[model samples]
Target: MSLKAQLQDEQKAAMRAKDKQRLGTLRMLMAAVKQREVDERIELDDEQVLAIIVKQVKQRKDAAEQFIAAERQDLADVELAEITVLEEFLPKPLSEEEISELISAAISQSGAAGMQDMGKVMGVLKPQVQGRADMGAISAAVRKQLA
Candidate 1:
């Protein structure tokens, strides 16, 4: 099934199961997806849906970090929980070893000799790593390799 259809099915199941937290998160996701469709006037494919989910997950993580920094454990926990919900639809994450290998290949493929070629390295790597690893971590790995 398409990710969007899977989400809608899960949303219905969550409602039937009275899973308030899951229901709320799914609703938020659906709203975001619907908003994007309406704004763009085009239906999103699975990849686009995955991209939206990844964006939501990032937002939750950032919010959780901000909450923690502000000493609001309860809010941080809530954000983290939402992140877990959002991540259910994401592809399994790449291991660090796998990411390192891929980064090395990208560097070699792009002939990125130093930090100056960071953009070239990333351009070669981003599509392969998107939604599977954090871009910040990828960039750091690229820097470490270049340095």
Candidate 2:
């Protein structure tokens, strides 16, 4: 089954089991995806779904940091739970070594000698690495290699 169908089925199961946390997270995810589809007038592929999941996880992480700064463990716990729920849909992330190698290859392929060509390196690498590794980390690797 497609991811959407699987999420719907799992959402139903969560509801049946009275898994309130899972149910709420799944509903929030579905709403975000549906909103994107409606606003962009385009159907989402699996990659797009994964992108949404990554964005949600990043948001939760940011919220968790803020909660921590404010000494709100309870709120941070909720965001962390949401992150766990969102992560279930993402592919396993690439390791740092693997990410570094890919960035190095992209830099070489693009002939990026220095920081001036960071965008060129990223432009060459983005699609290949998308949904597999975090872009922020990849950019750092590229910059480190160039430096």
Candidate 3:
């Protein structure tokens, strides 16, 4: 099933199970997806939906970090819970070894000999790693390889 359909099914299940937290999180995600579709005037494919989920997870992580720094454990916990729910829709994460290999391959494919070609390397890596790896980490790995 498409990711969006899977999300809808999960949302229905959450509703039937009376899983308030899960239901709320799914609703929030659906709203974000709908908002993006309306804004862009195009139906989002699975990759686009995954991108949205990834962005939401990143936002929640940043919020959780800020909440922790502010000593708001309750808020941070909520953010963390939301992150857990969002991550259910993401692909399995790549291992560090796998990510390193991907970076090496991307660099070679792009002929990225130096930091100046970081964009080329990232362009080659992003589609393959999206939703499966953290882009920031991937960029850092690419940077290290280039350097």
After best superposition, candidate 2 residue 66: deviation in angstroms?
A: 0.7
Give the count of colliding residue pairs in each prediction.
Answer: 0, 0, 0
Q: Lowest-lDDT window of 10 residues in candidate 2?
A: 125-134
lDDT sort, best first:
3, 1, 2
lDDT for residue 57 in candidate 3, whole number 0-100: 97
Q: What is the descending TM-score order?
A: 3, 2, 1
What's model 2's lDDT at 139?
82
Backbone clash pairs for candidate 2 read none
* Tens digits of lDDT, candidate 3, 60-141: 9999999999999999999999999999899999999999999999889999889999999999999999999988888888
Highest-scoring model, TM-score:
3
Identify the runs in model 2 with alpha carbons over 4 angstroms from their true place. Answer: none
lDDT of 2: 0.87
Q: Pick out the ten consecutive residues of candidate 1 with the lowest summed lDDT.
A: 126-135
Candidate 1: the clashing residue pairs are none
Q: Candidate 2 residues 1-147, lDDT tens each?
A: 778777788899999999999999999999999999999999998778877888888899999999999999999999999988878877777888888788878888998889999999999988777767878878878878899
CA lDDT, every prediction? 0.95, 0.87, 0.95
Q: Clashing residue pairs, candidate 3?
A: none
TM-scores, each model vs. reference: 0.90, 0.91, 0.97
Q: What TM-score does candidate 3 reach?
A: 0.97
